[model samples]
Target: MTQPGFLFTGTPLELTDGEAYHLRKYWKKGRQAHSIQSLAAFDVDVDLDALRTLVQLDCANCHLAHVASCCEGGFPFPPAAELLPVLDEHLDGIAALLPLDVIRHLLRKGLYERHLETAGHRTIGTFDGNCNFCIVEKNGPACMAHRYALQSDLNPMSVKPLSCLLYPLDLIYSEEDGRTLLTALTERTAAFSRWGPDYRLDYLCANVELRENLASADSPNIRENLPPDVFAPDSYRPAYVEGRQLLTELYGAPFYDELHTLIQGGRRP
Candidate 1:
C-alpha cells in the first residue's frame, strides 16, 4: 500500500528489492533533496578563489578537506572508464606538486591501466593502494591536482578533471530502454520541507539552510550567500552552480546557456 520513497505523487517510486535496499539505507538525504533539486537555482561567476580561502581559513574543522581515513588514502573517485584520456591529460600539470617517489611509482606502474585493475575508479599511487595525488596534510587531505587547476591559467575542466571539480555534487549515469541518462544531484540539503523529522535528521544535507539561517541584507556569511556580487571577493558558489559549470565543461558554453534557460523557465530536468 505504501511506496518505497517519500515526497510527491510519484512518491514511493518503483524499485527492485536490491534497489529498495540501498534506497532505504541511502535515500533519506536523496528524497529530501529531490524537493528543490539543487540544480534548479543558479549563481553565476562564483569566486572559486574565495571558496579556497574559506577552506583554508577553517581547514581543520571543515569536513570536505578530509582524507580517506576510512579507506586507503583519498581516491578522488575519478570519472567513468571512458573518460580516462581526458583525465590523463592533466597528470602532467599536477605532477610537479606530487612527491618524486609517488610520481616514480605512478609512472613505473603505468598510471591508469594498472590502477584501474585494482581500484576501479580510484586514483591510486604506487602499489600501496593510496591515491597518488592526495596530499595528506596535518589538517586533513588536500588535492594537489585541484589546487593546481584552480591556480592555473588553463581551463579548469581541461586541467582540473571532473572528480575533483565536482565533489559534493554527484553525477549518476543509468540506462533504461535504449539510451543512457546522466543525472546530477546534490547529496544533502536543509530544504526538505515535504517530509518528516526522520527525513530531515536522517536525510542530512549541506549548505541548504546555510543560506536562510545566515545571510541577510547585510553582514552575511559569504559561503551561505548565493547570487552574490560576482566581482566581490566573497562570492560563494553553490553546488548547483558548480554542477552547471561541470556540465558546461563536459559539453560547452552553449549547453550551459540552454540548460540555464530551461531551468529558468521552471522545467524539470
Candidate 2:
C-alpha cells in the first residue's frame, strides 16, 4: 500500500506556567515598547484590526496577555471541546489533501541567519498537557506554536519574530527598531504575497488550501497549515505596564505599592 500521506512526524509539544511567565516578559519587552507610527512607516501596517488580532492571539496562547490569564494560544479564546467530535465527523471529507510538508519545513526554518544552527537545539519542550513554560494546564486541542484558536489571556496573535513567535502576524524588532517595539513585517509581506501585486486572490486561495488540508488530514491543528510560532516583543515591560494599569484601575495606587513590596521580595504575583 502507498505510504500514508501527511504523516505527523512532529513530536507533541506542551506548555507550563513558568515558561509562560518568561515568554510574556519577553514579549512585552519585545513588541509593545516601540511606537505604532514607526512600525507603520516601516511598512508594518499597524492596522488596528490586525494589531488587535495579534495581541489577542499571542496572549491567549502564551499567557503573555495578562497575569492570571489562561496559558495556551489558539483562536476562539475558549473553543468548545465539543468541536473535536464534530471535526471527527468530517474527517472523510478531507482525504485528498496534500501533505503540508512545505509549511512544516518553514516552521523549522530560522528567522535570523544563524537561528536554527544555534537555537535549533534548544526547545521550550512539553509538560503535562502544556509546554513546560505554559501557565494554563488544560487547553483545547491545538498547538501553542501555531494555533491561536482557544488561547485565553492578553492576546498578541500578531507578535511574530525571533524563532519563538509567529512571523507575519507576529512582528518584532527590525534592525531599525533597535531595542524597542516589534512590527509585523513578515505578516505584512505574507499578506502582500497573497493579496498584493496582482495576486488579490492569494489570500482566498490560501484559505481554500487550508480548508482542504484540514478536511484531508483529520487534524485541526493550525501549525499544519501556517508557519511556526515565534514572537519577541521589545520587552516584558509593556505587559507589566498594562498589568499595573489594570491593577491601578481596578484597585488603586495602593495596589501598586503592595506590588512594589512583593516585587522587591521577589514574588511573581
Candidate 3:
C-alpha cells in the first residue's frame, strides 16, 4: 500500500500495513471508476461513499457554541509555490478587504516568503482557535475574504484558500494511482485508521447524530445560549448538495454535474 500525498499540508493519520491494505481495497472499490477531468487542469476521482453521506454545516454554531474545529490544529494550506500566484494576484485586494490587524500580519510576515520558512506549506494563522481572516462577532465568525468576494460580485472561493473553501471535502493525491481523490470524512471512512486527524467527523456539521443529539439535549447552556435553528435535523442535507457551490467553483459545473449524475446512479451527462 502506498502513502497518498495530501494536496494541502496537514497531518494525516499514519496507516499500519494491515490498515493500509484494507484502505486501498476499500478505496479501489468505493471510488468512482473514472476520473472527472476538472477545469483546474487535474483529474479528480470522487469517493462515491463519502459523496452520498448526509451532512449539515452550521458554521456559526460551530464557532459560537462548539469549537471551530476546522480552523485549528494546523489546518491545511497550499504549498508556497501554489500560494505565490494567489498572493500576487489577490493579496492587495484581500488585504484591503480584511481588518487592519490581519493586513499588518500579512505585511509583517511577507506571505510567500513566510510560508517557505515553514517548509513550503505553512498553515494559516489563527487567533483564539479561529482563522486570522475570521471576524468573530456576536453572531459568529465570518470569513473576511468570503465577504469581500461576495461584496465584489465574485465567487467566494475565488478569494479564499482552496483548502478553506473545500472544508471537510479533501483532495489528496494518490501516488500509487496517479490521480487526485476527492473525499469527505464520513462514518465508513472515519472507522478506518488510514484516513483522518481522527476528530474530523466529530463536529456538528459532519455528524448527523451529534447535531440531533445537541438539538434535543437537556443542557441549560445549549438551550439558553446556543442557536437552536443551527442544530435542527431539518438543516441537514447531503454532502454533495451542501458543497455544490465550492465543488463547482473548484472543479467547474461539468465536474459537479457528472458527480451529481454518478451519485444519482445515472450516466454522466
Off by over 4 Å in 3: 1-23, 29-49, 67-69, 72-76, 97-99, 112-120, 126-130, 191-202, 215-226
Clash tally for model 3: 0
lDDT against true structure, model 2: 0.28
Q: How much is 157 displaced in model 2, in angstroms? A: 16
- The TM-score between candidate 2 and the true structure equals 0.24
lDDT of 3 by residue, 1-269 (tens): 63553333222223445545555665666534542333233344344447656677666566565544445443335433454465456667666767777677767765432244245445456544455666655443366666667678987656666656665565655555555556666766554422353444345666666556665534332332445676677877777789998878766889788777766667664
Sorted by TM-score, highest first, which candidate order results? 3, 1, 2
Question: lDDT tens string, model 2, 143-191?
Answer: 3322331232322222211123222222222232232232232233333
Error of 3 at 28 (Å): 3.1
Write down the RMSD of all candidates, one decimal each: 10.8, 19.2, 5.4
What stretches of model 1 exceed 4 Å from their correct place?
1-72, 113-123, 126-129, 137-141, 178-238, 261-269
Q: Give per-residue CA lDDT, model 1, range 167-258, as digits (tens).
A: 34433221221211122322221122212123212211223333334433222113333232311223334434546666776667775665
- Compute the lDDT for candidate 3: 0.56
- lDDT winner among the candidates? 3
Comparison by TM-score, 1 against 2, better one: 1
Model 2 ranges with Cα > 4 A deviation: 1-36, 39-44, 52-123, 126-130, 133-171, 176-181, 184-219, 222-269
Q: State in Å the error of residue 38, model 3.
A: 14
